[model samples]
Structure formats: structure tokens, C-alpha cells
Target: MNGMTRIEFLLRLTISNPDVHTAIIGTLNPDHLKTNIAAVAAGPLPTELYTEISDRLAKFSQPK
Candidate 1:
């Protein structure tokens, strides 16, 4: 979704799952790396935000 940021997206993929041990991101640019680090520093998304994202994704996945 356009409203989701890189950090939120990353955390959503990693933090939501207990079996996931790590998430690897590839980036060559310094600025992009910094942003990615900051995203991880922000930690996992709150339950409300996660639920919202899940709901949005569910809607998006449905047949149009």
C-alpha cells in the first residue's frame, strides 16, 4: 500500500512471524542503508497498525 513505509513493510514481514529469525535487505547506496537501519531501529509495528495493514492486504488480494 502507498501508505506503508519501508520500515513498516520490513517489520511487517519479519516481526509478525515468530519463526522468522532475520530479514536481509540489499542496498548499495549510503542513504538507503541509513534509512533501512533507521527502519529496523523503529522496531515492530503496533498491533493496531499491523491489523490495519493485514486488512488492507486482504482487501487488495481479493478478486476485483
Candidate 2:
């Protein structure tokens, strides 16, 4: 999935705000899309952190 897309942000936002109920039924559908992205933000754990940590440990091997 393209991380830069609004859809990705919307999906993440929805997951984060599951309790924000709305009277507008259509707004809750999976097809609902966000054009303005003032609310969506990247998650707390950046994806690059995991990759960097894994790369740093690539040389370590446990004894058999």
C-alpha cells in the first residue's frame, strides 16, 4: 500500500477513533474517503525504526 495516500491515513484514523460515533450513516462505511488530511497523523511507532533495529542485529548469532 502507498503510505502517502489519503486512504492509508483514513484507515489508520478510523482504527484510532473507533468510538467517535456519527449520525451520518454513510460516513461510517468503508468506502468513505478523506480528502482533507488535517486529522490523520503517522502512528507512534515509525516503520523505519523496526527496519533499522533489525539491520543492526543482523551480525549477532546465538550459540548452537
Candidate 3:
């Protein structure tokens, strides 16, 4: 949702949690692997961004 790419956001989301130590991503294409590497190197999302994402998911994923 921020300036980060969708892949970056997803990876950073996974990396943000203290309980999470590893995230496995599979790819066949070289470019995809490169993008994934860059995403991981970008590191975890900021606390505010992570909380905003979790909050949005909780809000929208509720039964309507």
C-alpha cells in the first residue's frame, strides 16, 4: 500500500513478525528470484506500516 512493490509488501509482512524466522518463496524464473532477493533485502516493514496492514486485513476480512 505504500511505495513498496506488492512483493516487497508481502515479504516484509512475513518478515515483520517476531514469531517468524523463515519465509519460503519458490520461483522458476530468474527475474522472479531476483525480485524476491531484492524484496528480502529491503527488510521488514516499519511497525506503523505493518500494523496498518494487519488492521486493514482484520477490518475487511470480517464477515459482512
Candidate 4:
């Protein structure tokens, strides 16, 4: 997944799980780090997008 998708996935995972306190992401490049920060600043994914992602993931679990 792209950086933004990965970030949103991480944020969504944390938001879904109350037990999760924090998510630690590592990046050495300044630009990537800045982008990651921006992603966090953008806040949680919208409900529609979150549901879409969840649906997509759910498909993977179904018997094929």
C-alpha cells in the first residue's frame, strides 16, 4: 500500500481497538516523516472510507 493508505490503515486499526494506546512508525527520511505527521494531522479516516476498507479486508477472510 502507498504511504497514505498505510498511515490511514494504522490510524484506523488504533481507532477500532480501544486497548491500543499508540502506534509507533519509524522513518529515517525527513520528507517521509513529514508526510506521516501530516497523515496523523489529517485525523481518522471518514466512516465511509473506513467501512470500505473494512469490507475489502473482510473479503480476504471469506472462503474462496
Candidate 5:
């Protein structure tokens, strides 16, 4: 989404919350660490995208 790499998009999702202080991710691989750093550099998703994702998730999680 938003033409960003999947890692970037997922990292953005992980860090979007103000209440979230830290992220726990696999850090065993040196290359993975570099990828995580790059993803964080890309920052969070746009507000519109975040809101949309939240809304969709809420609906999805509702009893059907």
C-alpha cells in the first residue's frame, strides 16, 4: 500500500499508536536489523491509511 515496501508498511502500522512505546521484533539477523532500521526511517503510514485500516479491522473483528 501507498507504494511502500511491505516492511515499511508493516512497521508504520506497528508504530502508529501513541500509547505504544516500544516495538518487539526479531533481531537475530543482522540484515533483518538493517531492514527494520530502514522501515522505521520510512515512518508511519499516512493518517488516512491508518484510519482506514483501523476501521476495516474493527469491522472485521465484529461478530458476524
Candidate 6:
């Protein structure tokens, strides 16, 4: 997510939700207006992928 380009992040989010707002569109350059642009560029994950990641986190967090 950190290394993802602005274009790649938007494309990934759209893949999960076609209704997602496009207001997030903007440049990745560090500037006052570009805030939240980083989140948009982080991309959204599919439900399954998100669930799997959460499960992995739970496993790691369990007491040994």
C-alpha cells in the first residue's frame, strides 16, 4: 500500500466498489491538498482478503 501509485490504488478500490467516490482522485505529491490521497492510493481490499488478513492477525495475537 505504501509503495502503490495513485493510479493503482484508485483502480484497486474501484474493483471492490464501483460506487466509491472519485473525490479521492489527486496527485501523490506531498501537499496540503493531497491529504487522503494517500489513503485512496492504499487501495481497498476484497471482503475475503480482508477476512483472511483479520484471521491471521487474530492468530498472531492469541496467547501462546
Top candidate when judged by lDDT against the true structure: 3
Q: Candidate 3 has what TM-score?
A: 0.77
Query: Please, what are the lDDT tens digits per residue for candidate 5 over residues 30-60?
Result: 9988988888987877899999988988997
- For candidate 3, write residues 1-64 as lDDT tens digits: 6888888888989998787988889999999999989988888888998888889889988998
Cα error, candidate 1, residue 44 (Å): 0.2
Pairs with backbone N, CA or C atoms under 3 Å apart (clashes), candidate 6: none
Model 2, residue pairs in steric clash: none
Winner on lDDT between 1 and 2 is: 1
* Best model per TM-score: 5
Q: Cα deviation of 63 in candidate 4 (Å)?
A: 5.0
Order of all candidates by TM-score, from best down to worst?
A: 5, 3, 4, 1, 6, 2
Q: Give per-residue CA lDDT, model 4, range 1-64, as digits (tens).
A: 3345766667655565445677888889999888777777777666676677679888999998
Give all TM-scores, in the order shown. Answer: 0.59, 0.25, 0.77, 0.61, 0.79, 0.38
- Which is superior by TM-score, 1 or 5? 5
lDDT of 2 by residue, 1-64 (tens): 3454655444444534435554232355444434322224454224564345445656575345
Which ranges in model 4 have alpha carbons more than 4 Å from their true place? 1-21
Comparison by TM-score, 3 against 5, better one: 5
What's the residue-level lDDT of 11 in candidate 1?
58
When summed lDDT is taken over every stretch of 10 residues in candidate 6, the lowest stretch is 32-41
What are the per-residue Cα lDDT tens digits for candidate 1 across 1-64? 3466866576555777566887787879999888777767766667776677778779979987
Cα error, residue 4 of model 4, in Å, equals 5.9
Inter-residue clash pairs, candidate 4: none
Weakest 10 consecutive residues, lDDT, candidate 4?
Answer: 11-20
